[model samples]
Target: MFSHHGHGHGQYQPPATGPQHEPTFKIFCRADEGYCLTVRHDAVHWYKDMRHSTRVKDEEGHPAFALVNRATGLAVKHSLGQSHPVKLVPYNPEYQDESVLWTESKDVGHGFRCIRMVNNIYLNLDAFHGDKSHGGVHDGTTVVLWEWCKGDNQCWKILPWGPEAYAPPPPPAYGHQAYPPPPPNREPGHGYHPAPAFYPPQPPPSHDEPGYGYHPPPGGPPGAGYGNRLPRALASEPTVRILCRADEAYSLTVRNGAVCLAPTNPRDDFQHWVKDMRHSTSIKDEEGYPAFALVNKATGEAIKHSLGQSHPVRLVPYNPEYLDESVLWTESKDVGHGFRCVRMVNNIYLNFDAFHGDKDHGGVHDGTTVVLWEWCKGDNQRWKILPWFCFWRDEYCSGLILYYSTMRCSRPLPPALLPPPLPLPPLAAKAVEVVPKRSERIAAKMALEALEGPIHAVSRAQRNLMRKLGLVPERGPVTAEAIAAYNALFSKPLSQEHIIALSSLFSGSLPPGKAAEALVVCG
Candidate 1:
């Protein structure tokens, strides 16, 4: 359940568990198409307002931002750079400070909101009347601070930095491949099954059930009568995309309580379908040709034909004993290059012609109005099946993950994420010294200004982040509340001696680089 009380703060569980060592990831803002969460020159606040790169490293050659302090329930940012301070900040290592941390706050299904843990405020992106015409990003747009309101800008998608998050490369040539007919003993002859009762009693949906929303008519897994002998060969293919002869990609995507042809992209995991021969329900047509149900990877639902009205085809929870004739189709080489045809139960060809407008995303057909048409050997009538390959030991290539692209590892499991037997190796030395030229100087000034306040505590590294951001203000105009705010953020309180040393170092207006080194030993 979600709560709308107390400024609309809500609780949410992350979609996936993060790695143990707090791997760096790129946080993308959903409101904008391709902007990334980036730190400003001040290094005090962040905004999802920068164009991101797809290279292995950022333009500055640094790993992206990492999620840290997982146990604290606060998302602290950390850069992977060796010289970077142990504080939460974006990928820019030039400026380091007490690092800003945020909490998930709420999960609104499509996206989630982030609340800055430091000041209990929500991160927001300025929406220009809901039209992002050079809005609150770094393009001279205004990024203002606001209380927690759960606006669109606050919602984000934090994805790991690696190939897993990337779009698929160019597709392979469209090659048509068909599953071999089941061994003899499969009785021949096919006739349409009787129409099922209208809106048959439906079981309430459950998260526990594999395919809850979709179910086959007469309901159940395929081949209920077929013994539980698992076929070893059928599960051999791994990740793949099915191509149509028309040169467009065809996939069994979620449609009105079933699977139908929807638009596909390299990142679509649902595009990966499976064939379970051992338990697959095979039906032989009058000509003795065999067809099997195309099963979904996430849910075991198999493509089935519904006898209701339009003779619609849908994905139903598999049930072997149901003896459903609509769910079966025979694959034959159609009179076209690189394409095969699917013969539906009525001897009509399966077609996606009528509902072509909404091809990019998926939607239900016109309730069987144009589900099937006479076989015309058109683009919509042809189909192709691609097989998945195994990663390690190419032997036993079976099953592609329904939600991820390619079988390759997104990234190697970090040493800390592994078991105790494999300890985290010490970090190697940096081959180059990438210092913050201007931001660090400015950031150091900011840290000093905050230290001069009543709280009177500052760290050597914290000042380094502000070094180039700007020069320090003269030792005046510091307030008690500002000092208290700075003090409250420090995990380790600075001692009296350390405060006196920082004050003296600032009084002289010493060189930024040497001043940081002096404070290192003051404590």
Candidate 2:
């Protein structure tokens, strides 16, 4: 057995002495917390979850070895196509991707061991404790990265849970193959007839609201789109840096006559670019492929890569004439993180290439230049156009209050928050008391359980029937109380104004004051 040492976490390398077998051992941190390092089903990254007993094992209760890759000597990784902190996952026989290799390190220090993955990144939880920063203290929170220093959450113990405790592996297929040959198709116009294609049944409509039954078009508040994009959708959403393929946050700003890309701060205002499709130079590109301006909210300018000019692209005031072919840029394909912004004038793509003192007056040494170059699928060539939702940028309100007032009632709550609707029959709508109060109470319970449509409609039907019999109430409070009073007269309907008081009585929309009366008729 050989061991390699002295390297830091991100720079450590396993000794290249052919393939190595990582002994099967259960990992533990705080035994009392009962969390062991467990792998996701995808076999990418290991998280702080899984009990100590639930590790990889074979039949006959024997532990399984973590086969380290001969080339890299690292274990499972979370990030495949993207760059991220390396983490561990269980080894999968099929699809054996790049991260199926790992090596157990000798006690690094502080009487603890480390599990290093293929990319030389150690399985580190020193920076975080699976706490609120990562959705509160629980199992399966992200195991982060750090330089190798065994202390606190970074230190771990590999306790051997004997083979006797290992669970037996499931039996593998012996005779049947997964991809069996398809059934032979019959010749057209032959003696055989083909069967119709079978489709699965669909689920029932959602019934989380009053009018969500199989009738009345399942009424409730209109869809969010009905609000005229009041806290608008993603296209009208807030602007973000949209970190590029290079993993570097690029700041978009104009200095010395051209737009430049520099390293950005956390929330850099200079990097915020709004994609405005309202004005397009060509009518041909209006449909899905609309030409637009990358408007900077901070400076109130647009990126102008002057057509045919050798000079770097500069940010200038939006001119309706110049917006013809020069300023408008078309969005190409989505490049994973962002889109490729192609200059409409010359058909060339915009890029943030390193400025090596090109003698352009608008160039910066450390910063990147906005040059119009051929698209090569490079990281710097992609630009993310973030959306802005605040009223300062556009005249749109958050509509947060409106949403809560309208939809909050629909959610489930404790019994105290929503009292049962009062019991009252349509006959009670008149001053004459014929039905006994006990019978009305039993009828009310049944009515409440059955009614499932708009309260206003049910109320109207009741009032119309009462009017025909000439049994309308005299003046104030009908049926002795406010609920019955409101129920007697369907003509008086509750509006949005009564939401606050009604919000306490029901879970869906503000139930009409006479909603209880409507239920009796509906039942």
Candidate 3:
């Protein structure tokens, strides 16, 4: 039989037999500091100082415990499947539900332990499609069961539950000593005084004080530096370059007004693109994917899709509003290894056609033209988005050191040493009012049919509505097979009243007659 240990000793022992009678504890995932595992709205989430009970073990003789949230009184449950997410359910006092059981392993370091399910999958902080720049731990990130790979995101710390868990740790002792021997005395009525040359000298006055806070340097903003200025200056709008996944050495570059794949070069500004934050915010698509323009550093031109398959991408003058759809693209689908499919209008994607010549045998090489192509899930379609400085590390390391040094010193460089300021993009224009025309809509439908093959005109509207409701694939043509799949998913179709109610909720002003037509088509 196993024994239990008290709090603060960082030791927890589960009961070897019989029902659990141990004290409750807080569970904290090592992936995010200071946040503990909690149940919110029937879902396992990360929050501050939530308590859980882990005394009960599985009746089937497997070494596991039922994690029940103290606040919600719900037990954490993970279905015996890979696709299901971990959730919180009403506690069963009899302990009959086996899915509520979990097994905690030995400490993995820093008092964090891996909690595994009976299916051999571990409770993990979901970061499957996380951004590479950050660790990907954010507010409300879901908890899921994933195959164990020994990652810190899968390790959790068990802490004693109580008011003591919420108490802050004692601050470090500095001992008896005046902090900086007091700042040197200055002349009367003089508010500013120079600090000493030693490390971490007296800090400047706060922004509220007269003559303090961050003031723009003579040449540019606070963070801007000379020499290698692009990366440091545009910190708000990060500088990133697109690298072809099929050929890692080749990057998307603008050469002679056309987009092409060329060998990665640090000095070549054509390969560097700034992800336009302003346009991304204003011109996002209906699906919530941010459609941003990739602006080339050297030419100040944006990569524009010319519309239609096999059409060469061109570098056009930047349009802040993204009034033209050709200049907008979205990175919605992750394709592994920090790469994603850069999707354009409809189902077209940015592709490096390595098989352009000799369709059966051509291979990816330098100078290959980048063009628009229908989605085929090929490696040539995946592109890695990386910071421009990452590609020019060898050349900009010294500039980075100088930048950090200035940041530490808290002194602005002399005006003579500063580089010329870069021009900022014009503010986005007011959104253009769109007047829908039947002729234009028909033309667009015809274009889509040419690319993806034709669908029946009779049920087109119903199929499109079902696609929006996630009953069918959004990009493909509505075929008989697709209709059958939709029917299989929904055995009982909604009535005319239900369709009208849904339409009113979504569009608020959709006519009832149109909603009734939708129901008939759905039937």
Best by lDDT: 3
lDDT of all the models against the reference?
0.35, 0.36, 0.47
lDDT of 3 by residue, 1-523 (tens): 0011112221122213333333456666666655555554212211121122243332222355566653345666553233335665555444233345566676678887777653233333333322234555555555766656666667777665564533343332477321121134522112112212321112223432211222332554434232222323343465676876576666777665667777766556667788776656655543457766677765556665543346566555554532444466777657664567676522233343433522244646667887766567667777766665431143243343233223223255676754344321111010011212211111111111111223333234444445654444567555423333333333343344444444542464656445534544555
Query: Of 1 and 3, which scores higher on TM-score?
Result: 3
Candidates' RMSD to native: 34.0, 27.2, 28.2
Query: Could you estimate the TM-score for every candidate?
Result: 0.29, 0.26, 0.31
For model 3, how many clashes?
0
lDDT for position 150 in model 1: 48
Ranked by lDDT from best down, the candidates are 3, 2, 1
Q: What is candidate 2's lDDT per residue for 17-80, written digit by digit as tens? A: 4222222334545311345444432111111212222342212222223432211223334222
True lDDT of residue 404, candidate 1: 14
Task: Compose the digit string of candidate 1's lDDT tens values, residues 1-523.
Answer: 0111111001111224332223334554445535544332211112221122122222123222323222122224321111112232123212111123233444655755443322112223222222344343332233333334445654556655453322232333369322233235532111111223311113325543433443332455545322122123333434445545443433445444554555443334355665533323434543455656565555545565432223345555555444444355566655553356665532333443323323342323322122444455456556655553222122111111111111122343455533233211111001011222322221221121211112132333333332311222234233222222232322244444434334444455666456545555542
The prediction achieving the highest TM-score against the true structure is 3
Report the CA-based lDDT of candidate 2 relative to the real structure: 0.36
> lDDT of model 1 at residue 414?
55
- Judged by whole-model lDDT over C-alpha atoms, candidate 1 comes out at 0.35
